[model samples]
Target: MKAEFVCTDCRKQFIAEGIKNEYTDPVYGPCVIYTAECPLCGGEGREYSPNQGGDDHEHGMGPSCPSGGCCPGCGGM
Candidate 1:
């Protein structure tokens, strides 16, 4: 699924595409989550809705450094 988010740091908006994975959260029981990184900022974006359930919750990291794409999410690995 795809969603839009505004980077808190850069104040810019971007889209993120992610794959869904389901797992047992122990406390939450069955949980479905989508994880994706912002293309423009390479930030870790996360979103979820309790009412929707099994729905898309978008998330993003932060501004990216072009040198090595090093950020909290990618770690420049």
Candidate 2:
């Protein structure tokens, strides 16, 4: 099955195939979940599929370097 997730912070979407449903909390009972990295933000978490194509580049998603040619937050100097 294909699983989809959307990053709330970056508003990015990603899709994954052959998702495995595994229980995270053993004590909390059976709770199947799929964990994957966000293709747009590269964040280690859930990712969702896109409703349409061409939206990926349109939103400038992903952890791409800024136009300034440097990572301001990471101090890429």
Candidate 3:
């Protein structure tokens, strides 16, 4: 499951393995946080989806994640 992520520093869109985090956010209650790291700049990336996240953008090439985990794809969870 390759999901798109945008780097905070470069704003580049890349596909990577997404870590699905489920926890209680206290004020927000249950929350699901997806996190990934950029392969190019080693910066943190926020999960992106073509359908809900935003419009389509160019994709970068690299391993899904540094941990080598599979990530979800576009138009999906």
Q: Highest TM-score, which number? A: 3
Cα lDDT of model 1 by residue, 1-77, tens digit: 88654444444556677657789998989998665665667765454333232212221222334444454554544
Q: Return whichever of 2 and 3 wins on TM-score.
A: 3
Model 2: per-residue Cα lDDT over 24-77, one tens digit each? 686898777666666677665454544433333333343343343344444432
Between candidates 1 and 3, the TM-score winner: 3
Backbone clashes, each candidate: 8, 7, 5
- Which residue window of length 10 is worst by lDDT in model 2? 53-62
lDDT of 3 by residue, 1-77 (tens): 46888887777789999888789988999999787889989888888744443422212222332233234443221
Considering every candidate listed, which one attains the maximal lDDT?
3
Clashing pairs in 1: 43-61, 43-62, 44-60, 44-61, 45-59, 45-60, 46-59, 47-57
lDDT of 3 at 49: 49
Sorted on TM-score, highest at the top, how do the candidates line up?
A: 3, 1, 2
The lDDT of each candidate is 0.53, 0.54, 0.66
Q: Looking at model 1, how many pairs of residues clash? A: 8
Segments of candidate 1 deviating more than 4 angstroms: 5-13, 48-77
